[model samples]
Target chain A: MMDFALKTFGLTKSFSGKIVLDNVNLNVRKGDIYGFIGKNGAGKTTLIKIVAGLLKPTAGSLELFSSSDLNKQRTRIGTIIENPSLYPNFTAKENLRVQCKLLGVSDEKVIDKLLDIVGLSDTGRKKAKKFSLGMKQRLSIAMALVGDPEFLILDEPINGLDPTGIKDVRDLIAKLNSEYNKTILISCHLLGELAKIASCYGVINEGKLVKEITASELEEACKECLCIKVDNIEKACDILENKINITNYESINEDTINIYGDFPNSASINSELLSAGVGVNSIIKKDKDVEAYFIDLMEGKTND
Target chain B: MINLLKADLYKLFKNKSFYICLVLSILFSYMGTMINFAYNSFSNAQSMYSLLQMPELNGIYMFKTSFRGGMLFYSIFIAIFIASEFSWQTIKNIVSRGFSREKIYISKLISCSLVSIIITFSYVLVAVLYATIKSGFGKLPSHFVLNLIRMILLECLVVISITSLFVMVVFLIKGIAGSVATNLLINFFSGDLIVLGITLLLEKMFKKDVDVNKYWMFSYNNIFASFSLSNDVVFRGIVVCVLSLVVFTAIGIISFKKRDI
Candidate 1:
């Protein structure tokens, strides 16, 4: 069996008696890009912080590889929790050099190769404070990989990046997972980009993880929704309920309803509505994105 | 442990405030020795009678005068280093990198103490060398080595403890402004009041003989006093140094561990 990269049992944390994470249990398997999705203030950052050993959990047990052998294992784990943690006064090369020195990695060529990977090899002599937000972010990721970490935990890595920068990071994450075979746990608010890259997912809401699934299973579960525009939604619902036997539908308004499930029979439904004297305006098939799936999960309406 | 020490030293070297304090120390100590020699040489000018009541220009007096300004400056410098790490949020990064908090705390304490110790020792060496050149070393006292070593070690322990106190303050507030303001206030008004006031209150309450100078880290009279040769004084200085180190180090460690850094 592949090693379990990270595991937390009954993890809970509170500050000033206010709960930040309430009984959170997390499992991250090796060689998987597990996208951790949550809204703002949903304890995503807190969970990452605890795992990184930056904050002690109030009521939980965390055990990594034994410290005696941790140099071999822990040296392979990298992280960037919340904001990019780097000295703004130092150059990108200097920052990475310091990280490498901390890890006892003395290879200059390795540092250069890592910088080349992040496309920051030309940032020579330029302080991090002078770099743009995108450059600084890329440099931070490069720093995380200083020791050739086998597992990388990145929290909101693309929080403030532009579309291109987001794409760059998304591609980098994919490359890291696929090419490098690194077990990655990334928390991001941008579900759309996360959906494109993540192989597995954990949906957290209100400080509780409601669901975890593989990408293929999520793809199958989030079936297409048919957006139907009709003059009378109630009549359409009646027709769908009676003749079509379709209980999977939502009424958008008095004049429109979303028909989902069994998409091949859409033409039949249109003709059926026409024959039933129901004025059908349009029917559009819409695939639920990560956000819609998360909403469904939160509302307890997710497809099993 | 060596890596930890190297990291601490790296940080200390990078900080500009430490360099500025170091330069001030060297310059002031040199000036202090030169000025005394010049005064003695010009005593025949009939202008030095008004300053006759002043204490003798000894090695301890010259060294203290030269280094006192830098000592005060060193306090602020150490405070700034401790505060800036938290203020800039770089400490979170370091803590997250899996360095034990206790190790990090000890590293800082070691760095601060080393700086203080080195500064004091260098000042004394300069004062002695300059005095020997200007006014022929008059048979160096037998206890000179013992007392000077003890004095420097005492200053190191006291300054390190002071810096560690401010480290806790910085950790508590998690900001430079809050830590610096609170420390300045406490050091200037509250700390002295607590020391002198408590000592005086106890003396009056119990009709005991209390040496006010003995109760505080600093003493104005002691700074300018003549250095007499005595093994007892050196022994007492060693005890004071050990006590301060123990007390301050314990508090510093406990406070750091309990902090939310």
Candidate 2:
């Protein structure tokens, strides 16, 4: 059996008679970067808050490290939910020191190491309120990593970071998972950035988890294809199948067809349609990225 | 819980607002001593001392001089120190670390109570020392140390109970502005406006005289300055303090547990 870091069953949450999380089930395996995706009010943060014990579930339960005793099991977990849990007047080191005391981490040297890890070592005497947004985020991450928690849950860690800041956070997350042997559940709006680090994904929409897919599975689903719009649908299919011998194609609509395979470029496909006397409106090369897949999922266009 | 307390104490000492409140209370306490000194010297004379009277500043009422106004500063202290945990979301760091909410609530209560005592006694300490310099420690009642200790313990209970009430207000409001405003409103009005309103309403409804003083905390607080309580008053003070502490703590814990962080 696969060891799971976090798992929930039929978890539901409601706020003042309005359901925020509706019978949601989520699974995050050990040692995997699980990217939680959703729009605003999609229950991503709510579920994270519940898992962190900041909010109580209205119904159902969850297990951390496959144990029903969440209170005991949660000690091995670290989380950064919504904003960075910080004391604004204190410096970054001071903030981490408090976290250290709370977590019973006695190694004072770890403070310097964590500051160095987050590239915040030079921020001496600068209070957290004086730090820039990226610095605040980095300090929060360092604070979360204080006790070397096995499971880390970060809600929108890179929400408003610049490109460099985003890359820095991304690299730090990847390093923490790779070098530290940690399991992470992170939610972010930047799907492209998340796609770079997440090994698996959970997509939630309208307070419901729509799908859970691995990176390889997502790569397959979002494979590069050639999209062609034509006037003649039947003739185009016959010509493509018989003439081009490409059977891996999907008919998106009456006039549009998406062909997926190691086929020639869009120009070749376009010429093939024209040579067969089929009216080809347009033939463009399409690389469906994570953003595209997410849009399709949100729009309910995908059957899955 | 120990670790949480250590963290809370670390925060308590590091917070600037705490020192500000402490200094403000001490200043007010010293001002009280100066006013008493002036009143005893120049009560009948027409001088700057005539303008210094606030609610008849006669007799070296050290406890009242230090405590009544000092409690107002404690309101701001408790509100800022506790409520900011919610506003700044620093509480999440502890709660998400797997510490039970009950432990967190209790730890906060202990810290707030301890700090309240510190603030309250510091105010008293300033008055007692200053008054000793100006006009020695007055006549010692029989069994002076023992009686003083007893008085201090009762005052501690009252202070804890009052701090717990402020904690409940902060938890329920959970915002700095709202919590601070409500705490001040309660501090300024609970003793007079609210109790007076209740007294009038009860008298009119029951068609008789009913003394609500024994049942209310401020009523007990008013009598605490006397530095000696009869068995009856001590029993009633203990009952009122214990009851308020339990009720306020329950409400605070319930409010904290039932909400979404």
Candidate 3:
């Protein structure tokens, strides 16, 4: 069995009488960058907070490092939930030192190293209050790394960053997972950005875990579909359905049809259409990206 | 628990509000002494009843007066220190780092008590130094110093009790302005006065002379006054202080643990 770094079963949360998360089951294996994708008010932060031990679930159970005692296991994890929890009056270095003290890490050298890792080595006594949003986000990430935790949970870690800041954090997250062997569970609404680094994804919508799929499985599930344009689309569909024995296809418009599944012989289909007096105008393969796949999952077009 | 304590202490030392509180408390204590000295000098000059004729410069009187004068600033200090955690969202950070809610609450309690004690003693030190310089320490007998120590220790308990109450407020209100406002209102205005008012009303309604000291546990003046009274009253005061500390701390811890933040 692959050792799971974090797992939640039937994890639910509610504020007052409103349900925010409903029976969400999530899993993050060791050494995987698990992307938690959800929209606003989708309970992404709620779930992250519950896993981070900052908030307790109104119902359900969670396991960290395969241990049912999440409180004890929380020491092995680090988190940055919602906003960066920082003392504005303290400098970035001081904030990291405070985190170090909280985690009981005695090494003075790790502070500088983490600052350098987060590209904040030159903050130089400037208080966090004066730092920009990007700088604050980077410092929060650096703080999360204070304990050298095995698991890192970042909720919208790059929410308001510029393009460069986004890329920098993306690269840093990838490096932390691949190079440092850290298992990361990151939540973000930006599917494209998350797609770049996430090894697996958990889609949450309306306070429910809609789907969980590995990146490769999602890639396969979103495989390219062959699109064909013809003068007589109905006759082309008849030929594709009866002659070619292809039932996994949809008529897009009056002159276009999309064929799913493995039909490597596109020329044969065109030839078959032509022989049936259907003029083949164009043939193309459209690849579905992560964004389209995510939309499909959110809209309940695909089975979980 | 040790790590939590260290982190809390580190934050306490780094907090500018704590320093501001220290400075303000010291200045307030010195200002009280200087006002008294000026009054004594003016009274002595006028050949009226000299203010120095009153036994107010001894260690016991100075400790009591300075501590009482510093209580307002002490409440503010607790409010700022605890409420800033909410304002800054650092409490969430601490909670996320694997510390139990009880541990975090206890750590804050210990750290706040430590800062309160430091502030209290700093005030006491300044008051004593001023009194000695003005009156030459000749009137401060050995027993007076001993009683001063006893009162200071009892005053520390009262400070801790007040700190616990503030902690409960911060956890309940969970905001800087709300916690500070509520803490000041209770500590400065309504905490003891309401209790005393109710006690007097009951005494009048019952048509019997009731020993109001028993119900004056929240009243610092009464508690401190009891120190000079019978040992039984002092024991009762100490019990009340300890009970307040325990009750407030329990409420704070339980409420904080159950809170969503």
Best by DockQ: 3
Q: Once superposed on the true structure, which residue ranges of model 3 sit more than 4 Å away at CA?
A: A227-286, B40-60, B141-146, B190-196, B218-222, B225-229
* Residue pairs whose backbone atoms clash in candidate 2: none
**lDDT comparing candidate 1 with the true structure:** 0.72
Q: After superposition, how far is residue B163 of candidate 3 from its true place, in Å?
A: 1.3
> Which candidate has the highest TM-score of all?
3
Error at A292, model 3, angstroms: 1.8
Candidate chain B TM-scores, in order: 0.72, 0.89, 0.86
Predicted complexes: DockQ each: 0.31, 0.72, 0.77
Per-residue lDDT of A108-175 in model 3, one digit per residue for the tens?
99999999999999999899999998899999999988889999999999999999989999999999
Per the 3 Å backbone cut-off, how many clashing residue pairs does candidate 2 have? 0
Task: Please list the residue runs of candidate 1 whose C-alpha ends up more than 4 Å from where it truly belongs after superposition.
Answer: A63-75, A225-263, A266-286, A298-304, B27-52, B56-60, B64-69, B122-139, B143-159, B182-199, B219-232
Residue-by-residue lDDT tens digits, candidate 3, B12-35: 999888899999989888888878
Error of 2 at B228 (Å): 4.2
* Candidate order, lDDT descending: 2, 3, 1
Give the residue spans of candidate 2 off by over 4 A: A225-261, A264-287, B44-61, B192-201
The DockQ-derived docking category for candidate 1 is: acceptable
Least accurate stretch of 10 residues (summed lDDT) in model 2 chain A?
A295-304
Error of 2 at A167 (Å): 0.5
lDDT tens digits by residue: candidate 1, B1-261 = 455666557667767777887777777778877887777667645546665544456554455554333454455556777777776566665666677777777777777767765665566668867876665555465688866665555555555655555555555665666766776675565344676887789899989978655535444214323346356654555455456556766776776667665
Each candidate structure's TM-score, on Cα atoms with residue i matched to residue i, is 0.80, 0.87, 0.88
How much native contact recovery, as a fraction, does model 3 achieve? 0.87
Residue B161 displacement in candidate 1 (angstroms)? 4.0
